[model samples]
Target: MPVPHERTSKKKFYRSPGGAARVTYIRGKSGRHHCAYCGGLLHGVPHSKGVAGTRALSRSQRRPSALFAGKLCTRCRATAVEEAAKVKSGFKAAEAVELSLKPFVLEAMARVE
Candidate 1:
């Protein structure tokens, strides 16, 4: 049996050159980051098995630098900006925005000039 920490890890079997069987444990890889609004995979985020692995990456390598970089995809960011503009211009009411998009729109509005 594997140690306590590796109990949940997957096992791989291999044959040694001396004709002995060996087992190795492998921890699972982390899933890719996803956009908060669109539920699509976010780019520029590192995939690592543990916190230590992630910490090894530099700040810029961990996530994008743009606004809502880790949370929203480019397309959704554009949509939020557009919705915010409409709300600010009186073309769309604050309460009229979809609930899923309301928070993002408001965030964009806050950052606008």
Candidate 2:
């Protein structure tokens, strides 16, 4: 039988539209704290003992982008950016040209309202 949505007390964060391509994490498991930049598990073997310290120090310490592997799902993010570009703004087309390509920013804006 297929595993139920909330198996083993794990909470699932499904991809928008809520289905497959979903990601779930158990409270005390490696996936419990995944990197916000990439979906990779943040705290566990091969990774730091815990990201809490790294995440906190990141604000003060310089970090290289190579750490996150630059892997991100641009599907929804691209849509949000397209939606924002549809509006006129003082940010100017030239400046926005760059922000428009940032997956997290674009996609995040799209989901709002």
Candidate 3:
């Protein structure tokens, strides 16, 4: 007789499209948090423990910036950056150049007038 396999629910099986690319914290037996993306302990990584601190104190503290490395492991973050750079490189150079030159063109026009 063959054994029947149990079906898993979608809630437990499905992961978001961004899930693989994102960094999440998982509590470990050691009581230290681990990076879900990298499987590395989060101890060495710097993050703001709480938002209760004042703005000045927070600013003085070394916290992750908006574009700073997120919860993902270092390896994952590097891969993500590489992929983004590839996508950005695919953009038309002329469009980028135009955007960069707009301010200079405006300045030149002002000088001329």
Per-candidate clashes come to: 0, 1, 0
Q: What is candidate 2's lDDT per residue for 1-113, written digit by digit as tens?
A: 44764466666666867565776665643334444444544332233435675565554242333322223334433443454555434344534544534555445455544
Tens-digit per-residue lDDT, 30-56, candidate 1? 788888999998998877547887888
Top-down TM-score ranking: 1, 3, 2
Score candidate 2 by lDDT.
0.45
Q: lDDT of all predictions, in order shown?
A: 0.88, 0.45, 0.41
Error of 1 at 32 (Å): 0.5
In model 1, the worst 10-residue window by lDDT is: 45-54
For model 3, the stretches where C-alpha displacement exceeds 4 angstroms are 1-30, 43-62, 65-70, 91-113
Candidate 3 local accuracy as lDDT? 0.41
Which candidate ranks first by lDDT, i.e. highest? 1
The superposed Cα distance between candidate 3 and the true structure at residue 63, in angstroms, equals: 3.3
